[model samples]
Every structure is written in structure tokens, then in C-alpha cells.
Target: MGNLYLARHCKTAWNLEHRIQGRTDIPLCEIGIEEAKMNVGFLEALKISKIYSSPLTRGRQTATIYATALEVPYETRDGLLEMDMGEWEGKTALELSALKPSLYLQWIEDPRNVPLVPGSKEDVFTAQRRILSTILAIYKENDEEKNVLVIIHKYICSLLRCALQGLELNHFKKEIIETTLPQNLSIVSSQVIEKCLSNC
Candidate 1:
């Protein structure tokens, strides 16, 4: 079993604009670069052994800073990819509400039960399954004492945290807001995740 430190990629230009960047390959803005650098201090004492990230540019960029600084092996994992928001990918909340108020409200109230788009849109449960499997597989590959760093997006991070805490996917909204707030980094032991999965 390994310990994992999960981080959401830092801010982007779209993030600054309050946009939904799901599955869009936007790079980190200048503020995002600085934000990731700031996290370096927080990670200085963690002694992370390996780094994994979403294949997206923002996640890759943020992970690169830490991987280079700590001299750890870094790789991109497809399972870490952000949710595919479909038609809503580049739209802001305000825009989405204006376009489809009822749908937007439904999403805000219960994202796990609502579909953002008609077809081919990624839902919370699907993404959670992918991310949970990825983390579990990674956990099985490492020793109990190893510390693994994984970076992805805010929504995925929230779902992963819910799983680690043995919470249902529906509880994701009740959990702390990881995207717009601090404490975007979460640490969970591999054993806890395994137990959570076994009980399920």
C-alpha cells in the first residue's frame, strides 16, 4: 500500500474567467504557474517518490514543476483525464444557466444524477470509476511506505476524495469545494482506498 497526494491543476485563463474547462487542453496561465510554484514549498517535506498526472496540458504543466524540482519519475495517465463535459466544456456557469436554467440547477443540486449534455457526456459515476481504478492499480504497484503524487482536475479530485473517505458519489457536492478554494491537495493512504473498495 502506498500513500497518495492528489492535487488539482492550478488556475488557467479559462479558470480565471469562470469557465468550465472540462477536457479542454488549456495550458496554465501565469498565475497558475505561480500557484504551482507556491505549492512546491508545501511539498518540500512530503518526499514524494513518483508523480502521475492527467494527460491534459494544465495538469501536465503543474506536475512537471514538482517532478523536475523533486527529481521524481513523472508520467501521464489517461484515467486521470478530466470529465468530458461535451457541449458545456467551454461555457461558464452563468452562461450555462442562461442557456439551460433548469438543467444547470439540476446539475448544481445533484451532479451525479444529472447529465450535462444529451449524449457522449461524461458523468460523475463513470469518471469516478475510472479514477478510482487508476489509483487502486497504482497503489498495488508500490510499497506501503511509498508516497505517490497524482495531479488531475478539481472535479476528479473531489470524486477521488469521496471514494477515499468511503462516501457515495452523491456526497461530492457536500464535500469541501476543492476548485475555488484552498486545500486542493488531499492525502489518503492506499489501504484506506482498498478497504473502501472492498466494502463496496
Candidate 2:
């Protein structure tokens, strides 16, 4: 198995506003730039075989910052794209919650049943699983990679948990995303493949 580093994008203006930025491309905030800079150690230590990232601005910015340390071209993978929230793109979670409380609740409690937003073409849950499958395929293909860094968004990050832990397919809380990261970008670190699934 290839080693994986599933990283959350650095914060953006929307992130600080507590607004939902599901799939709305936004640049990293200044603090996010600093945070991304601090991740240099993790990057240096990873000795990553290759760096992959979602195409969104936040993800791209984060990858570029990391690439400075890697001295390698960051590979953009659409497979790692963020979940498309459609009508809910720029609203805060609370704001959108008010607009679609029932849908919002279902999204959090169990995303599989969360209906597609009015104009979005894909279901959040389905998209997540598809992204995860793409990631797993990357993991499988990179048989010689010592470390594989996968830059993604919050929702897709939760999906990775399902892939690694066999969790029920659901939209799970932001904690799934937050906890995956350390307070300072330490979450979902570079772990040895053997150590990650020792029991297997």
C-alpha cells in the first residue's frame, strides 16, 4: 500500500466567516498562508513520491506552498475535487441550514439521503465515495511510493475516513474533517502503511 497524506486546505475568507464554501473557489487567507508555511516540516519529512491536489484555489494554494519544499510539480487531480454544493456554495452552514433545515440535517446525520441541491448535478455522498475510490485507485497504483500527499476539501476528507475506517456512508460532522487535521495542520499525518493497518 502507498503511504498517504490526506490534507485539509488552508483557511480561506469564507472559512473565517463561518460561512459554507462548499465548492466555491476562494483563495487562502493570510493566516492560512502562514499555516501552510508551517507545514513545511511535514512536507520535508514525508519524502513524498508525488504531490496531488484538488483544482480549487484553496487546495491549489496549499499544494503550491507545499511544493516549494518538495521542489516538484504538484499534480492536479480532478478526482480529488471538492464536493459541489450547488445552491449552497457560498452561504454559511448556519445560513444554509436555515434555508434547508431538513436537507441540512439529513446531510449531517446521513448524507446518502440528502437530496441534490437545486442546480448541482451530483449527490454529496455519491461524489465523496467516487473521490475516495479514485484515491484508493491512486493508492493501489503507487506501489512504489513511500508517501502520497492527497490535497482535498472538507467533505472529501470525511470520505477518506470511510475508506480507511469502514464508517457508514454519511455526511458526518466537520469534526470528521477537523479531527483529521491537527489544530496546526498535523491531522492525517504521514503514517507507515504497516502501522496504519497493523491488525490486517
Candidate 3:
């Protein structure tokens, strides 16, 4: 029964431009590095036993900062990777709306039902199952850890949050996406994981 500290990676240049960064290997911007440093104190107080991160540069960079500050070991996992956005990788929301209004509107109305992009390998439901399984595996493996930090991308974090709260995938855009901002942490308790699994 451990606490999972789920955090989104700090901002990248693409984040400022409001570009979709799904599966893109963008490094952290200067401000993103500083933001990670600033948030160290809060995370340090959690006494994190270990840190897990997405393999993406941004996620790894943020986890490295916290791991160094907290003096904890850290590792990366592929399951924590951002959803593959395919053709939408570098486009901004406005551009997507302009270029593919129907696709964009379909996503906005029902994210779970639509393909992330034309060539993407995983849908929202697939991503959700991957993240949840990864998290449950981590929890089971590190039973002794009082607090474990998991740094991942914004969309991945939102998906995990939505699942942990026992909400359906359709609730992701309306309930979780906007609120799951970068550098923000969401606490997931053992009981919450149990509840999530039971619901599944």
C-alpha cells in the first residue's frame, strides 16, 4: 500500500506554442528546467523512495531533477510514453481545427471513440490500459515504497488520472485533460488503485 505521485513533465517550447507533442522527443526548455528545480522542494518533502519516468527527454529530465534532489534512484518505462499522435504530432490546436475540422471536433466530442491521428498505433483506450497496467505493476513491485514519483507526459498523466478516479475514458477531455497541467502532481493512493482495478 504505497502512494504514487504522478507528475507531468515540465514545459517544453512546444508547450508554450500549444503544439501537440505526442511521442515527439522534445527536450525541456530553459523555463522547464527552472520549473523542475523550483518544484523539487515540494517533492523532496514527500520522501520519494524511487522515481519512474517516461522515456521521452522531457519526462526523463524532470525525473532526473527530482531524483537528484531527493537522492532517490530513477528509471524509465516505455509504458509511460505519451500517446502516439501520428500526423498531429507538431500541430497546434488551432491548426488542427482548421486543417481537420471534423477530426478535431470528433476528438473534442468523444476522445475515446476517435483515432488519435490517422496513423497512430494506439487509441485512448489502449493508452489507458497500458498506463494502468504499468502503474499497477509498479505498485506491486515496490510494496515497501511509501511514496513513488512517476513523471510522464500530460496526456498520459490525464489518462491515468481519469482511470484512477474510476471515470470512463470519455470523461478525459472534459474532466481531466485541462486540469492535468505540467509540473502538477496528483496523488494516487493504494485504495484508489484497488478501486480502479475493481471497476475495470
Candidate 4:
């Protein structure tokens, strides 16, 4: 199987403040830029042939640094956008828990059911199966030993991991993924995960 690297986007204002960026279009904060630079190391090692990113600013900026380092122009793909958090765009965790209690509870209980903000839900990679189809299509059309990086959101990265491993989605939690992925920079690939699992 070919190698695919799914890297979470760098920090954002919301990321720093613990807000749910969802499909929000906020630029990266100061720390996010440094984090992006550090994370670009692994990607540069891969010698990525083509880079793809969410059309949103955060995602694009995250990948652009890597693209510049790799001397390749990054490509934007709408399919790879982060999930739309709707009203939760820039609300902090504490704020949401306190102010939008019921909605927040529902969101924590189940994200799919929450009413999405306009022009947000349509751009999400919510399910693993859907992402698999999209990624596989990209692979099928561009067959080669190419390494690619898709800079996306934190949760979407987990969902893609779930899809690659065929893990159950509902029972899947984001915290588990947080601990598993590299702290500032992480690499996600079907082959790498499989090898790690096999060794385990």
C-alpha cells in the first residue's frame, strides 16, 4: 500500500484558547507558527511529491510551511476540510459548558446530531468510510510511491485513523487519539499504524 500522511493543522487562536475551531476560518496564533515549523521536519523527510490541505486558512497555512520547505506548491482540496462546529466556532470549552449547556451536552454526547453552522457541515470528513472513499479515489487516480500530506483538523485526523483501521467510530474518543499522536507534530499512515499494531 502507498503511504499517506495526515497531519493535524498547526495551532490557531481558538486552538490556543481551547476553542472549537470546527470550520471556523481563524488564522494561526504565534505559537501555531512555531509548531508548524517544528512539525514540518517529519514531512520534509518524507520528500512529499504533492501536498493537499483544507481550503480554510488554518489548514492551508499549516501545509504551506511544509510545502515551502519541500519546494512544492501546496494543493487545496475542499474534501479535506475540518468539520463545521456551527455555533461552537470560537467558544472556549469552559464557556460552552457554562453558557450553552444543553447544546454543549448534546455536542459532547454526539457531534453528528448537533445543528451545523451554515456552510460548515458540507465540508466535513465526519465518517471514516467517506474519508476512505475520498482518499482512495485520490490514490487510485494518482498511483505511485508518492508521499502526500493532508493538513486537517485534530478530530478529522482521528476519524481518518479510525477509517484506516476500520475502528468503531461511536465508541471512539478524541482524547485517546491525542495521547497517541505526536505531541506537536504527528504522522498518520495506514502502513505505519498497521506495523505498529502488529508489533503490539
Give Cα-based local distance difference scores for all models.
0.75, 0.68, 0.77, 0.62
What is the alpha-carbon RMSD of candidate 3 to the true structure?
2.8
Query: lDDT tens digits, residues 1-200, model 4?
Result: 24566667777777767888876788988888888787767666676777778889988887788888888867887767666666667778688778634666555544444534344554233444445555655555444676666676666665666555555444335422432113222324445444433432
Model 3 clash number: 0
Q: Which consecutive 10 residues in model 1 have the weakest lDDT in total?
A: 176-185
lDDT of 4 at 126: 41
Using TM-score, give the best candidate's number: 3
For model 2, the superposed segments whose C-alpha errors exceed 4 Å read 99-101, 179-200
Model 4 CA deviation exceeding 4 Å by range: 99-101, 109-130, 175-200
Candidate 3's error at 150, in angstroms?
0.5
Structural similarity to truth (TM-score) of each candidate: 0.86, 0.80, 0.87, 0.74
Error of 1 at 28 (Å): 0.6
Model 3 residue pairs with clashes: none
> Where does candidate 2 clash, by residue pair?
19-92, 20-92, 181-187, 182-187
User: What TM-score does prediction 2 earn?
Assistant: 0.80
Candidate 3 vs candidate 4: the lDDT winner is 3
What is the per-residue lDDT of model 2 for residues 83-145, given as tens digits with 9 covering 90 to 100? 777877787777666763457666766676664765678776567556756665666666554
Please give the ranking of all candidate structures by lDDT, highest first, separated by commas.
3, 1, 2, 4
Cα deviation of 20 in candidate 4 (Å)? 1.0
